[model samples]
Target: EAGVVQSPRYKIIEKKQPVAFWCNPISGHNTLYWYRQNLGQGPELLIRYENEEAVDDSQLPKDRFSAERLKGVDSTLKIQPAELGDSAVYLCASSQLGAGGYNEQFFGPGTRLTVL
Candidate 1:
């Protein structure tokens, strides 16, 4: 009975402070994704990985954000100099069907970060 795990369900940081989030996906699942949800908006895909390979990350902000999935299992996302606009939900999800599991992503409750 394992689900997507995320630490620090809530975080508080200054506008220019650095913050990071961690995630552990369900065992045996090969695909992982990180999404950002703005208030009153749908989750936006920030990055997607397949077996340690980042398949898509075009929407990720390379300047201030970074992500990695070393073993394609657990992953982490970091934000350097977090901005007030970065205050949102950072969701992590994964599924057994990596190639065809478009709708199989099991999302976590998300880490709600507040930047001042």
Candidate 2:
């Protein structure tokens, strides 16, 4: 089966510009997460959603970052006034809650952003 898909594998933009990334998760996966992976570091969770509701977004920078999974399928993450520090790989992952509480996430190729 096909896994998650993300658009614009790479993007380069000037600092302070607005940017957006899109993701389409595997079919029937109800849980989704957005993560940011910096150079030489593991991905950090930015937001999480169960169905169409955002269940966790405490790590997301509300001041400049926002995300939505309106239909619990495709999701979009946006950053306004992007800063140089925002340069990183934005990843989208999805998983299904299975028996015995097993949930293994499958990640997309990710959108690499470079803020110059």
Q: After superposition, which runs of candidate 2 have C-alpha atoms over 4 Å from their true positions?
A: 98-101
| Candidate 1, residue 74: lDDT | 87
TM-score of 2: 0.95
Per-residue lDDT for 54 in model 2? 87
Worst 10 residues of 1 by lDDT: 95-104
Instruction: Show pairs that collide, candidate 1.
Output: none
- Residues 19-51 of candidate 2 have per-residue lDDT tens digits of 999999999998888999999999999998888
**Per-candidate clash tally:** 0, 0
**What is the per-residue lDDT of model 1 for residues 1-116, given as tens digits with 9 covering 90 to 100?**
87899998999998999999999998988888999999999999999988899889999999999998887788999999899999999999887755534557789989999999
State each model's C-alpha RMSD to the native: 1.3, 2.0
